[model samples]
Target: MEKEFNKKLNHLTKVNLARYSTMRLKSWGYLYELESFHEARAVIQELKKQKRPYRLIGGGSNQLLSSWEEGVYLKLPKADLHLLSVDEKKMTLSCDASTTVNAVLQLAKKYSLGGFEVLTGIPATMGGVAFMNAGTSLGEFSSLVSFIEWIDGEGNICSKEFLTSDDRAKNFSYRKNHFCGEGEVITKMILKATSRDDALEEKITKYLNYRKETQPLSSKTCGCVFKNPAKEMPAGKLIDGANLKGVHVGDLFVSTLHANFMENRGEATYEDFVALVQVVKEEVFRKFHVELELEVKI
Candidate 1:
């Protein structure tokens, strides 16, 4: 830590009144944002000392924050981007938890790299996306990742590779990665991608344009409120059929644009969002005999 930062730490706290998400009115979380990998490790130790539970945070684009949290909210600080190496046929990018996924994608696009382009419009950092397996049909982040690295609870760095089928099985669902537990923090991620120029740009433009038209790119809410069921029914369509296209509770309302999106209209409470989610589920189940499962982290 720098001399100035050490001075700031004297006043820095684990508990904070910070807005936790980018969309739908703001909800509150006790923000414990870290700015460096060392700072992240230090913050985890602090939380362990206090014996308080905490959740990791990214861009806050795809999650809901409660107005009142039951535990500490750990956010990776905002200056962890470090470009490790970019090769001829493949590229390797390693980033701290604080680096947003968009930043990495932007860097790769400028260099004419292709694999990360599918994630062009998705928000959050590479660490967060890797943890949650964030992706779109064009591709999920897991498909592009070759190895993952993180800081253990003991404060030691470790790396894991799941490129082969056998190794990949350990991850229940790429979307359901359970490695971090409650207090562990991701340090960086290394991924390999095909090197292509014209095709990569074209793919990126198509996905980005489609995302803008299909999703409320301008609205606030965690992206895609629920996961698609294995039975082939989309949660959004179910919610819409149940007549929840304009549903609202407090300032939280389902996006008029997409049923799966819950817009935070600038002053909604976390309670409102949760309540609306319940309503959508119950109504859908009552009428269709199908239960809607939430994918949003609340």
Candidate 2:
């Protein structure tokens, strides 16, 4: 069975798949560089045929495949923007999800699009943002999405859900719509954006400056370490208030730059990240009459 599995796996990486995907999750993993969507589909088909395990990865910016699970990782063939279709009349654009959010923002700016100015600090693939409904303290990611193109189970491509007003009474509670499901995938996104003007440029500048001053942009950290529990408070504030900044477990430590970010300072391990999160949760619960939740995948 194992031999059969390996026979079907394509361009497998060197690290023990188990260790790379889970125990030693890092900025690096079974590094396979693909070049197109068809190649990915072929691999997925083979895995289904061989009954082998695999997990799709994009950006590798938000994930925590635990040691307890075993699988392979698949990625979009490349990180290029497959398409960027703008509609000045609607103030929206259809974007490729494989590209980074920053790239999308730059594209938006080139076209004088305004809705994405608030996302300057987020550094992730557009697909990832949709998968997690990623957002800031002020708002959620889904609010800007007018529609999306996704691949459903069985690999059948589908388009934006057309719902009536009553059918759309509830916004996606999680704020994620485009990317979802273990076996399904998302190929692109369509965002409801605004046309830019002088005022929009000023707001963009403010967000860009905030990112420079408050985030560890120069380091190897992924992003925020934990999600804020609600509207009134933030996770970093809670952790810092508990005096947990700079706390360490192995090579990973809560970043001194921002208490909510746990960073891998060269030798950090999965164990270090997970253990430190436990510390933050405990300390915060003790200090405040509240509990904190993780923003990081692990």
Model 2 scores worst on lDDT over the 10 consecutive residues at 16-25
Residues 222-259 of candidate 1: C-alpha lDDT, one tens digit per residue: 88988887536877888888889988898788887889
Off by over 4 Å in 1: 1-18, 172-174, 195-197
Using alpha carbons, what is the TM-score of model 2?
A: 0.83
Per-candidate alpha-carbon RMSD to the true structure:
2.9, 4.2
Query: Model 1, 267: alpha-carbon shift in Å?
Result: 1.2
Scored against the true structure, residue 108 in model 1 reaches a CA lDDT of: 71
- Cα lDDT of model 2 by residue, 9-63, tens digit: 6555544332332123443345344455545555566667767676766666666
**Best candidate per TM-score, number?**
1
Once model 1 is optimally superposed onto the true structure by TM-score, how far is the C-alpha of residue 262 displaced, in angstroms?
0.6
TM-score of each: 0.88, 0.83
RMSD of 2: 4.2
